[model samples]
Target: MLKKLILIALFSCSAHALDSNIIEIMQYLQRDSDLIQRGFFLNKFDIVQEGIEKHKVDFNTLQKFNIDMFLDEKHINYSPIISSFLRNIKENRIALEKFLKDNDKIRAYEAFQQLDYNCMKCHALVRGW
Candidate 1:
């Protein structure tokens, strides 16, 4: 009985820690996304680069958590979809980097739009919308 109680306590604490990490990652994502958009609109390469770097770190940190925690009951089995979202995000990030490096604003903007699309799609899926 004592062992079971300790295990239960550990599980609860682990879940709480995962939730906290997810929330912090989402906050970082929002901040970096805003910075990226603002930089693109203002034609500030430095800001965009900074945002992209930070966003990359955020994604890496996010991958360390159990993604199912982000989903509602209706979408609990949608881990594959969430994984695809991550792939799309990675593709867009690479494209954005290449375009920005080449000084191609138009292509960078398009990649950014795709990145935004993936983010919204993932959010909708998780929220069961």
Candidate 2:
């Protein structure tokens, strides 16, 4: 009984920690996304580039966390969906970077929009909304 209690306590603490880490990651992503949007609207590719770099760090941190923590019977298929969204986001970022390098605001804007759409779609899936 004591061993079971200790295990439960440990598991609860770890689960809480993981939840906090995920929340932190989401907050950072949102901030970076806002920065990128502002930079785009203001015609400041440099700011957009900074946001992109920050987002890369955020993604690295997120990947470090055990995503299996987010899985359950209801979300058994979540992993593949997450991978697909990550791939789409990566491709969109690459296109955005290329467009910015070429100083093609129009294409960059389109890429940004696509990125936003991908993010929203993923959120909706996760939240079941």
Deviation of model 2 at 52, angstroms: 1.0
Q: For residues 56-82, write the lDDT of model 2, one tens digit per residue.
A: 889778778766677777876787887
lDDT of each: 0.90, 0.85
User: What does the lDDT come to for candidate 2?
Assistant: 0.85
Which regions of candidate 2 fall more than 4 Å away from where they truly are?
Answer: none
**What is candidate 2's TM-score against the reference?**
0.91
Clash pairs, model 1 backbone: none
lDDT of 1 by residue, 12-55 (tens): 99888888888889999989999999998898889999999999
Model 2 pairs in collision: none
Going through the candidates in the order shown, the clash numbers are 0, 0
In candidate 1, where is summed lDDT lowest over 10 consecutive residues?
65-74
